[model samples]
Target: MNLGCIVGLKEWIVPQDKAFFDLFEQMADTVNEGAVFLNVIINNYVDVQNQCHKMKQIEHQGDLIAHQVYEQLNRTFITPLEPEEISRLATALDDILDYIDGTTQQMYGYGVTETDDFMKELARLILLSTQEVQTAVRLIRKLDDPRAVEQHCIEINRLENLADVVLGNAIKSLFATNDAITIIKLKDIYENLEVATDKCEDVANVLSDIAIRHS
Candidate 1:
């Protein structure tokens, strides 16, 4: 709170801004990679366990980045963005990876060795959503163009709606089939994919909030 302490704190935070944004971009990249892996696994229907392992690694990487973000938040007396916004964005980004990891694990646990069109479509939608997320997060560093940032958020919302429709039709088809256990297994996977988009929407919401505040 004293002058000298304040000056030292400001100096410390100067370097952290770049570091924070760098980590955020890296985290977004990793999440998008996970989504790509998920789509590949679903479309090919081979080596799923190994692919799930890869996604787990990415999820671990996201955790490490999130931890660093929080550690920096705690140590710095000043931040490039609001401390709460930083925390929210970090948490939201982490959740997207977490859901991706969850979907991969469920595929293995449910013995879903075959790929279906619905699953593939959902996976593709997830990939698209994450791509938008990455773009929007990077644009945060260039928020002078608020319209540009909001466009990405709008795309994310549209993708989320598309994912919802995919989920609905998937569940509807599953119920029409008489294989009860298969229905149960696929229902879980479908819901997880949907939840992943929901998390992506969560990221979009946080990004929108940040843009509004900082615009």
Candidate 2:
């Protein structure tokens, strides 16, 4: 193997990594749509089962795209990113939808018919965090711009903090109510919302890791 041929081959292999970034951006967009659907289901008092079914479709699509990324990673001889980092990024993005799906399933199962102020607030935070995740993933291709990527991660962390406070206050009030079953149900829903925000933060953390290593 001549030196020039080796360098050219490596250059050709690097472009293949672009597919990962495209798929990641697509997944983030789907997550954003799922967040929007959740908010509508909670706020509007719509047909809960129907909304949940739609959300499931979105989740399934995200799963397919995630698997495609994994398959591509397996087949490629050389990747622009470390295999472990690519795997972590894919899993973190997939987990966001999992949390969203879990939230809707619980809502329908618990027979939640209306939305309270706390649920509305949590929904807002989830949407915002997903937006940040989308931006961060898109910017990740240009790791030299660490400042831009770090800003998104910082915002995600801030949103997660706000969600924690909302969950705490909501739980405190629920404890004061006399209906034990209702209390249990609301607690489960609130906790799931908080967990979804945490998952978004996880995605941000993964982006920060990639940025730091590449920059």
Model 2 quality (TM-score): 0.93
Which lDDT values do the candidates have, in the order given? Answer: 0.90, 0.90
TM-score of 1: 0.94
Query: CA shift at 86, candidate 1, in angstroms?
Result: 0.6
List runs of model 2 lying over 4 Å from the truth: 1-15
Best-fitting candidate, measured by TM-score? 1
| Steric collisions counted per model | 0, 0
For each candidate, give its TM-score against the true structure. Answer: 0.94, 0.93
Candidate 2's residue-wise lDDT over 27-80, tens digit each? 899999888888887788688898888989999999999999999898777877
Candidate 1 local lDDT, 81-158, one digit each (tens):
999999999999999999989988998988887978988898999999999999999999868998888999999999
lDDT for 139 in candidate 2 is 92
